[model samples]
Target: MAILVAFGTIDGAGLARSEDTSVDALQLHGPLARLLRPLVRLFIRTGMTFPALSQLLRELYINVAEYDFALPDKAQTDSRVSLLTGIHRKEVSRLRGAGAPVNVVPAALSRTSRIIAYWLAAPDYTDTTGAPLPLPRAGEAPSFEALVSTLTKDVRARAVLDEWLDRKLVSLDEEGRIRLEEKAFVPQNGSEQQLYYFGRNLHDHIAAAVENVLGQAPAFFERAVHYDDLSGPLAAKLETRSRDLAMNVLQEANREAHSACETDAGGDWRWIFGIYVYREQMKPADKDIGKDAS
Candidate 1:
């Protein structure tokens, strides 16, 4: 339920390259202090919360070096993760897996093995009789045939990969051929480094959301609803679960920011969504409700 908010290409921040724009600054640095300036009385709005999109980031392939989570303002967490992280729910519903993030071979494949496999398997590829295709490089999406041609050369592996591809762990190019099919999304960079950016992006998002909440909240909220109480290490947890929630956020924020969303809002406001994995879990609570119903 913790959602990582990202302003995709829609915001005009480049998805494939980092831009030194103010939006990128908002993503990399906290701006509540500055945003508060000259705008307190100015009307503002909290943008849409893309909880499903956050989970998609985890389940799908994010070429960290190539793609940045652009949060021009701020991003915030959804409420469910916040709630669920507290009570180790006795009846935790299993969130369906985010499909394999690309079907590329695991990085563990050593150089020599890659060579051997390429030689032995490349020829067997169909146009894929079926050997899997090589994974695409960051930002270099490929067509299905191209992906299949690269990863595999025979049938059996292709079948398994085909299943994964259908499920979205892999995606094809315009030709309806396999392209970005790397299954194992190993952090090509240091794991911590990758997580750090993920968390920062998430961090910026949540901060922005909370900023909106704080700015919109009544001049003085009751203790239970105060901004600080809902954020920080102290808010969102019972005494027993505080540290757990804090640590969970700590480890994940650097890896994925919405880990905080779980705690953002509890009760009816919460939702769990991950398009690449559990997107199917969501549906209209009532057909008559608007998109904002959640």
Candidate 2:
């Protein structure tokens, strides 16, 4: 059986996936193999291997089965855990004592994020039309200083303002009022923020994919368009186009999501919508490598 995957490209570019390859019901393993190649390379770069990561995965699987799954007694036993994770009962017991459990908590919003969130959503800081209000630099009430005060007294408004100014998140007029230049907290030219996002975003994303793979109903939305042969200039243009389009959509979605959460009586969920563009240089073909013999 062949499958037809329609891939719409960025701004008139097309991606054509061949239908020659056999597409079985559970043919997902091929994609998984492709995904794992770079992941395995990443592991090797960080001095890790399949065995250690596999053990960690097994431990996590058991932990989730015990705590998350609805069992008959709502408690996990060695035999039950073994059955769920395909690990021996003795190994399950050993894993329990091997290390501390990894706590999967909601990623806490930073102070900067909180301030930005409020600036974007709070009625006091935003106009009636939901646009961010240009705020007076400092005052007793209804000012940017006041907003920062409501968030944290320990962190002075001057400190926050300086940081934001340095990052170009906000701009100050000659009159000293500050205007929000962006709707989101963007860490300008910094690896720390990017690295933090790398861990947090990928963790939730992989968790969603794993849940769907494990037969959880109403699977999380995970879809992408991948193509192999694009020139660097074309790829760059596509990336710029994607970034603009994604940001426009996400900003509106962010407003709606935050508004709904704020009005809801029971705030029982945490969610993140992450958009990223990745481009990498492909390795030379094996035949070319042999010809070069470097």
Candidate 3:
């Protein structure tokens, strides 16, 4: 006998089978609405209409059904995809020929990120305390030139320096040594690089949540601390403390990963460790609504 669970079924052998369970649409509605609210807000602010988003979602539905839900050793048919996604068979057939969305990291963004990672982690570029050291603009080992050259010799170190200077990612100290800014990892506002990360990070976070919700084993780390009521001063203090702790964790992880990768045989596997903090003022009406629901 198989014991049915909210998400799936556990067989007599004690193995869970997620495919045996049907998804409850009502169970998903509240969560889906919460997830889509901010995204829909972004679309409206960016002038993306409902029709445009609908078309994009239609294509994605077909793509996911065809690729992700396909049976082993079986050709995916339009009818099957249509049934899985609740999209019309004709629409599924039309989109089946369309290319899947490509996930390409911008060249400049990739290069810059790697360079910063190395600077933060490599012993030569960091101090005894593991902080990135200010480097001479040009010279021998430990200089900015050496750091850039270690990553790539195709682009001249001076050219890279100039670009970083223009973007204010790095600044020259009184001694003319180049110092990386604290916010160097952040891309320019409204830039292509920023948008790329916005999509990629959100997608990864949501994917982890979905995997856990689907009762997948070996769940990814997903946890948050929340407080509804706090004085302004208390909230500010907590926010500052949170930022410091988060940065310490990120920097330590970066150092460890950097050392591991030095001798790591490169493979198709990729990993991301991300942290985010958000604070919003609660309106009186919103508080009342919450009280009523509770």
Candidate 4:
């Protein structure tokens, strides 16, 4: 991505905003390059070459340049846009003539996401304290089957249950009750789910990070804690504790947000709050590698 950005921009120097800082330059930009390595490998496996990505990126870069760069008196010229985006003047004209991006999410995936949303928000599916209630598999109006029907009549309740069970988001008890095991319903496998996640999760996360760097006044929640070294046993304990603490906070916040949405009568604002836990082991250092080879 960095290399593509460099090649596409003026003299191989990519576009930078005036507000960019030294910390932002190193911390954000450097990690982004490393992050794309695995994604690039996936693209290769899927037959999406660098050229294809570059073509799509060209259009994206043009869109950003058109919006982010201020227009002087009169219309934004192809020459000026070319200078800003680092694309050639003729190519800028051609790209500018092209249509805007189309957003067409699959109906099934969208309905599935809505089901998860309603499951979290609706009072029928939750207890007095706003915790999700373990529901009977079938029978009455408030049962799990009824909940599935409210979202979509096309899909059966058992099908939805099977998908959730496959993802480990929900579990079925021996007595035929359905219990929510995860705060959010995420598909563990399938291309449709992966694409949905790529759109939803990555877009929101990147947007929040950008807002924190660029926006002023009330900030969005963005924070993390990291340590380089820890014993394996200690790290395992910390992971468990972190998951517990994060889930409790998130579930409480979810209840409050749902209540606010229900009561607020005259606004069109929407927001998402997400919690994620990640841990990975560091590669052995060169010094340590030599000792082990002896």
Task: Say which candidate scores most in lDDT.
Answer: 3
Provide the RMSD of all predictions against the true structure, rounded to 1 decimal: 22.8, 7.1, 6.5, 8.2
How many clashing pairs per prediction, in order? 45, 0, 0, 0
How high a TM-score does candidate 2 get?
0.67
Name model 2 segments beyond 4 Å from true.
1-29, 49-55, 97-109, 122-134, 140-142, 151-196, 210-219, 226-228, 281-294
lDDT of 1: 0.34
Ranking by TM-score: 3, 4, 2, 1
* Per-residue accuracy of model 2 over 133-228 as CA lDDT, tens digit each: 889988865689998988887788988889888877799888878999863456544345555665687777777655555544555665565455
Tens-place lDDT digits, model 1, residues 125-214: 212423344443223323233433444555344564565556454575665544433333323344443444344544444444444333
Q: In candidate 2, residue 239 scores what lDDT?
A: 85
- Model 3, position 74, has a per-residue lDDT of 100
RMSD of 2: 7.1
TM for candidate 4 is 0.70
**Candidate 3: pairs in clash:** none
lDDT of 4 by residue, 1-294 (tens): 012122111111232322432344555564576557668898999899889899888887777787667566667778878898899988887887453443567886777777766776677888886667888988876788998988798889999888778867788788878888763454555467667776677677667665645642355555555444566887788789999898778767776776776778856766777766766675677235324323
Better of 2 and 3 by TM-score: 3
- Pairs with backbone N, CA or C atoms under 3 Å apart (clashes), candidate 2: none
